[model samples]
Target chain A: MPGVVVVGQVARDLVLVVDRVPEEGGSTDVRERQELLGGKGANQAVACRRLGAEVELLGVVGADRAGEDVLAQAAADGIGVGGVLRREGVPTALLVDVVGPPGVRRLLEDVAPAALLTAEDVRSRAGLLQDAGAVLVQLQQPGPAVVEALAAARGALVVADGAPADARTRRRVLDAADVVRADGSEAEALVGWAPRGVPETVRAARELLEQGPRVVALAAGDADVVAWADGHVVLPHLGEDPVDPTGAGDAFVGALAVALLRGEDPRTAAWWAAAVAAQVVGTAGGRPHLDPDRLRETVRRHRGA
Target chain B: MPGVVVVGQVARDLVLVVDRVPEEGGSTDVRERQELLGGKGANQAVACRRLGAEVELLGVVGADRAGEDVLAQAAADGIGVGGVLRREGVPTALLVDVVGPPGVRRLLEDVAPAALLTAEDVRSRAGLLQDAGAVLVQLQQPGPAVVEALAAARGALVVADGAPADARTRRRVLDAADVVRADGSEAEALVGWAPRGVPETVRAARELLEQGPRVVALAAGDADVVAWADGHVVLPHLGEDPVDPTGAGDAFVGALAVALLRGEDPRTAAWWAAAVAAQVVGTAGGRPHLDPDRLRETVRRHRGA
Candidate 1:
């Protein structure tokens, strides 16, 4: 199978669960904080891997301890780390998180560790992108450079999660991507909505059709989704209390990329991806494995794919 | 002599230097990165210790690995950590930094790990504050709560380093502080300024008197400072090519608190603090130390007090 190449926003997520948000300058009593192997690239790459897509992670991590942890986690997830160039002088990027009440998450992240990926490293890994079936990119790392690399690749279907994108960034990405995935808020941002609700989000997704992605997946929290490509489809929410929605979008994209690689129809692929994402929600962390049978069943029952 | 108290934001700081800031949508390469033990509280307390102040840090740290490092650094600095309460639940607070060319500093900080400080910890450390000759507070920690604690203290000469303050916070602190220190930019932030040079900063210092601080110390980078109290005095900056200015402010405040405890006149003490701060600028990292002779010579040359 042609592999899905994930690039951009690599990080080691340090997660902590505390009683409350530290008051403005007020401190909290931290009960538990654990380092989780994560980054936008790694999370989506892991998502593709667990959903049974051959995936390769192309990025640079430091030669420091966090890099070792990044390699270990990538290896465990079966994503290629060999392409990950290691810089001896720099430390890995870190995302510090505070998981607050009702599952609200505050991410304080710095993506500079991935910034150490020199032009030479990018040049060296250029060939890997050529062989992949699909390429996924996030905004965490530098976005334009990744776009330049994607522009050079002819074969792969480009999946862009224009997350963390502002007006200018989204415009830059809309031109480069084949499938664009927008979270509820991002969709609002793209269409210039004010204090958006479900209808506004739906209206925004419809307007995104002009930007030219073949498919646009807009994930609205519990309202599930309303998507339009050839026509409109309202997909049901997984209907489970999301243990942690940290990587749900990554999983959705990963699974979607995998289905697309398999040459499934867009609707079918999205259904399969949704089922895979829902199953992942049952697990506590991001990018949990999707049992082959369960993935198929959810696809058949809900996602027409 | 009564000891000194540093009441401010305390957390571990990770410092990294890169070639240039990442372009709006692009990435840049990092040349060096390091984890330096720091926090405004930790920096000031450690500075006081280096300058020979009997100092105690009154704050909360998480029970995680970072907290352990914070504890160890405090021990090494000879600052009492008994008041450094370790709550079992939270991870220690952290400051992430990206410093660019010409020594520009951007504090990409997350105080999540520092959320562990509780009201109880503040209450427990109250008596220690009351007995101190001087107390230093920075805006890195919660403002309102810290202000309340200072308001309750009667004996300590409260020196509020309002380097990073807002109108509301400045007002609250002025009500409780004996002296409030602000850099030229910070002073301008309170009362807008278009100062051209030394005269402008001096003029700026005069404007800060309208605020509640009995004295205002305005620090201009590597230049003479203008202080307003009994009378105006100009203490020249110790000339040095600074590699990193991370803890210079803390060093200044720490040495100032110590000098006050030693019963040095204010101008003489400011000179002592300037020397210590100059030493910090010469060093590559935070909280660099200076012994008795180094302190005395720097003071004697100034001929201020």
Candidate 2:
């Protein structure tokens, strides 16, 4: 099977749970902790692989031990490692999610310049990207790398997530991606205003569809709106007051790409993606535990509702 | 030279600095990050070694990569690692210090039960501790291990820091230690109440001296009091407001031990410790960077003030 290629950050995610944050100069115990393979790109790749896709992660990790650890974890998750680059003399990117009460978290992202995807790193994997069945480009990477991935993956289905860092990249993303997805704030950055409710989100999604993408999915307030040229569906968010929302968007996009790859209708794929993302909102950290059978059952139930 | 032995926690310290903590469901980039070997025992041992004393650390770390990393760091710092036991199948303790502007920090400590020193682990190093010139016991370890360390180091000049865990442990610590030191809250736990100022601290210090420790040092408000059987001196804390106080007490304890080992009088040694602690207050993490000549000059300036 020609694998799906995920182009973005590959990092170590450390999730620490504390009852309450201590005052300055005070100390508190971590009630729970999970150190795992994570990063938006890595998480999405994990989600894709979990849903039975042969996936390749095309991201940069440091040549350090943590870089090796995350790569080992990714391989254990059944993601291909051939496209992954280990940059020398740098530290792996680290995402620390310190979560407290529901929806309360402090995210400390240590993303060094060298840890980010470089244009050179992407070009090195041009053949792999070009040969992919589908390409998931996380806009968190540098503009050049994101554009390069889009250019290389012209032969495959292209899905872009998050707001482009600059206007040139944003224009290139809309022109190249088959589908584009963003959360509330990212939508504001992409389209000049955040879609707050059903009417605004649907309107914004249509405007984005006009830009060139065949479909656009956006998180607006408590609902997710998925719009194509003809129609749009605004689905209510599944998890109420999510415990943590770290990886929900990644899972949402992964599910969409996976569903489309399996030939599901765009509307059903969008609903399926929303359902899958709902599962992640309840868990800590961004890594998805995607069981296709369960997700299908959830989508069926959610559609009935 | 007979070495100074330190018994307590050995952890990987991850210090992250951000301009402001992100709200619930928000993200922020860490402006500065420092990952190093830290924990009270390790910090004090580093301090001792930096001050030109041979030092050995007696602690438990997981038989994991992080454990190896910290052990390697300790060795690089010129501290003996033979007594640093690697417990099987556990994770090295991790302390994440998230600092914002001056004096604001949120500490998350992930210290697994197996990573803490066991009585058996302490006893295995009995000969090394017994033959040491001095022993610094950080009270963060379990009562049994702390007691075992004290028992093993009966021939060494013993200094105990922090509040003993239980009443029985308190009694054992007082009886076994030659010197005792406690920060404000720890002092309150050691005694019934914390000392607030010079007079109250002096009275409290005198009271503690009767409990078997030859010298008692207590942090009281902005001042530190060091008292012996017949004499006591109150030194104003050198730093106006400490930027980070995670390792202040550890450095203080280390400086005291190093000074006493070099045949300094109790008052001058206390003054020296206070001066050294002032230097650490200006930095992040608990690791001390001690320079004897510079520290001596700072002590002279501090005493004159």
| Superposition error at B151 for model 1 (Å) | 4.5
Candidate-wise lDDT, in order: 0.68, 0.87
**Number of the top lDDT candidate:** 2
Interface RMSD, in order shown: 8.8, 1.5
Worst 10 residues of 1 chain A by lDDT: A22-31
Cα lDDT tens digits for candidate 1, A91-185:
67776555545345555555663444444566688888888789886654454555555564557888877563465556766776777777765
Residue B93 shift from truth in candidate 1, angstroms: 3.0
Error of 1 at B124 (Å): 2.5
Runs in model 2 lying further than 4 Å from the true structure = B240-242
Clashes of each: 14, 0
TM-score of each: 0.56, 0.97
